[model samples]
Target chain A: MVDIAAELKRPKIDAHCHVRAGREEELSSQRLVEAGEMLGITEYWCSRPITARYGSLEEIRAGNDAVLAAMRRYPQRIRGLCFVVPGYYREACAEIERCLDAGMIGVKLYHQYKINDPAVWPVIELCTQRRVPILVHAGYVTDPRTKAEQPRLSHGADFAEVSQRFPETMFIMAHIGGGGDWEWTLRALRDSSPNVYVDVSGSNLDDGQVEFAVAELGAQRVLFGTDGTMAGCVGKVIGASLTEEQRHLIFWGNAERLLAAQGKQPLAKIESGQEGVAG
Target chain B: MIFDINAWVGSWPFRSLRDSTPQQLTERLRKAGVAGAAVSQIEAILHRNAQPANERLAESVEPYRDVFVPMATINPTYARWEDDLRICHEELGMKGVRLFPEYHGYEIDGPLAKRVVAACRERGLPVQIPHRIEDMRQRHHLDPARGVPLAAIAGLVAAYPDTPIIVTNARGIAQSPLWRRTELRDAAWYADTSLAEVYFQGLDKDLALIVEESGGRHLLFGTHAPFSYPEAALVKRATLPADADTLEEISYRGAMRLGLTPESWAVKAGSA
Candidate 1:
């Protein structure tokens, strides 16, 4: 009666989808919600425009508001995470402040802006001061990742300095460090930084890093994030290590805790994240 | 009711024992809600001779006896090809034989490859061959040599139209409308859900076209183990937007059609 079955049947969260200023520009947030519903994915955190040229506060707000509008259409199923280039901190911080006021839960950093660069240092300061999690694109750039992975933002190596600089701030490394130049990224996640949590998004876990990561960093640290393409979501999660209880955590429990702590409501149904199109 | 024709049961050198064991793998299969699977050995593919590995594979099928069927890997290049096929057929009762022509380094049209394909045909055996596992680029080589061409396999299937040959490694089937143009009507292909899926490439016409052209009976669910996660394939197969009848044909009956039961296989000269 708890609708646990329906909730269990709910779609997975696509932690890193994009708006592209085109794909979803005119489509109603309801259609976006429908897309998520069809796939049983209830959440979409838009993080495209990850480049230096996308270095304006206005660009961040446009993408951020697009995602927020989707969330508004299906309040229970959507949440928007803001994207910013670390090279422009004041601009990035200004957008983050706006997103925070609008109830965003996390900050997204593209590798185009070096994590170690002074430009991003202030963005981290802002996110940390506000206690929002920052997700970074960490992995090898040349490893022939699918076309969905673009703009080889600096690998996890760029951010080792950032994590060291701010130990209390939460850092989520997308792809769990195995995408490319993975070993060092894994090393950083496991040893170099305490607040760093790795997600198996848009990466292959076939090499046993998922279990190893769970062993090194508790299951709580491995957040589930897919690059948000249909196939990417399936491939990333199908190969993870969480047991029945833990899968619930990676899928939603952990996200629910993080969102609730920030005053957000968990999606109650499987249709919350549906894309609006019927085809 | 969903049958996963392309899955594996054996220890993988790199993947942990959890996804490799029969019990663990079967449970994982069941979790995907597949009714049955046609299993082969990943460990055997590593065997240099493919004899002990074939023998080892036949034995691996014991635990999942009810829900699983055996597939033997044959390296006809091995000096004992005749003996390996005998043991695989008579002793272990494997339903089919899988070949790795690339790893074995033989052309599908070559004498040895044709001989193995013919041997299975003579004994009413279904033959399977994996093209390549994992993203070929991610594998050991940097863009390893191309798999035995689908056209080449089309040639083999055309040669022996009576024998059912299931090719597991052909990534080209989903893209080629030529599957409809093939002269081999008795010939068919199995889509390893692992390799069957198209990703960020944004090209998904292959599966739809193949399903339509082959009338769905030509498709079977397979997962190239140690190469891809089986659950992903299952999800892909389940999510295929085909009609109910077509879905049943591809997911379940197609594999059964590829199989030769003990009775049919046991049919001998005296009975004939």
Candidate 2:
């Protein structure tokens, strides 16, 4: 019998979490990290949250700065993902170099430009050469209202197209359950690109989502993420009808392998009973 | 023991569900450490008349009475609903009734809704209102289902302050304007911690934040399972930064307060 409560206590990695640096974002960041800790998350891949559809160059830099700040504060618990807007090619490339030099593990992209957009190509190539993953914010929105609203939001097909082009670059699709039709998103992701992996994040928590994603995309291409809903994400993984090996892969094995290949190690010294020790 | 206040055992027409049958639901719930669940039928939401669905629910759950607390589904808009409600309570031995105002095509705070609540109240039965059966964003293009708003629930609770109200599969109840109203807040009302779970926003918006905000008194454990995975809700409850008392309140004590004690119900039925 599966002891789910005990299973939840197993150490894992949260592949997608937003940890910001602004006055208010700091509190949100702290809560997210604390929640992850309570849920036995060992490493949090932190990114700067972008509220606007399109952010200024300064905003993008500032977002990456916040992630860097979080990494400095919780060196073991937090792993920074450099956020950039591919539309700002030169600046975005420069920010990626700066963040990567400062120990950031990968890149985080939003819908400012679709993954397949020409402007994003160089960014993908840069990450591919650097041997880092590009985590793209994607939504397969079937809802006409949201679809019209976020016309530029990248989808599974966009990732499929872009990923096929840069077969060497590892691509992490943001959230299958965040919004839009996850079923449609999973269906689109099926047998598309081996380079394209998806994070089981977001608040949807639909039954059979994790199982379906595993079956559709294969376990190696599925990652664990909360996108802020920490417990729900953990629950989706533990609750699914997966082999222990599959659960391990989703929880931290895939991430551990992927980051290790990029010469990145998130947890240097896993601390216990460390709370409210902000730098 | 964990008593899940929100769960369903029947096929969802829009999407294929795993472990949607009573036996499968029982096995899944047990694996997740849930001792019992208040289960309804998924077909009841879309079926023209909910009587047949309720009958099916009774038969399906009969074999798993130890794990299932059957809740009848009533479409007040359908004719002879009163008779169906009576049969569900008396003959079918249902513990409660769940209403789908949005799916049933009627105003939640309208006279017909009030009549159902009043009738259930007289029978000392709780009324469960699921905010949405499926993720509103992921519904089939042809399926036009909408979620039950917090405002409509406020209206229902304000009108019937003494009625035991269970609002399941809802999000943002604690942060809603209606939740701040004394009339709705003080009533014998409960919301499940299924859909309104942890999110990236500030602690005040999701279920984790509300455990402190509402003292866990107004919250109950729910999976909205088969439609949603039960593990998500179970893990969410385990991660709540709450004291033992608060956790117990949300897990099963609150449900017990709502008269979900099958032991007492059986004794009462036998005596009657």
Highest-scoring model, TM-score: 2
Model 2, B1-272: lDDT tens per residue? 68899989998888888989988888888888887899999989988889999998999888887778899999999999999999999999998999998888998889999999999999999999998877666667866658888888888899898898888887777666457776566787888878777554324456655676677867889999878878888877876768998998888778877867556544544576
TM-score of 1: 0.73
Model 2 chain B is weakest, by summed lDDT over 10 consecutive residues, at B198-207
Q: TM-scores across all candidates?
A: 0.73, 0.93
Residue B135, model 2: Cα distance from true site in angstroms: 1.3
Best by lDDT: 2
RMSD per candidate (Å) reads: 6.6, 3.8
DockQ of each model vs. true complex? 0.17, 0.60
lDDT of 1 by residue, B1-272 (tens): 56666677776553344566677667766765665677788767666687776677666667667667888888877887888888888889888888877667788767888899889988878887676544432333333434667767777777776777777745556555326555544455455455554332122345555665666756777655434555555555645557888876776656666663222322431264
What is the fnat of candidate 1?
0.10
How accurate locally, in lDDT, is each candidate? 0.62, 0.81
For A73-140, candidate 2 gives per-residue lDDT tens digits of 77777888998888888888999999999999899988878888999988988999899998888888
lDDT per residue, candidate 1, A62-87, as tens digits?
77777666556656755667877766
Error of 1 at A273 (Å): 20
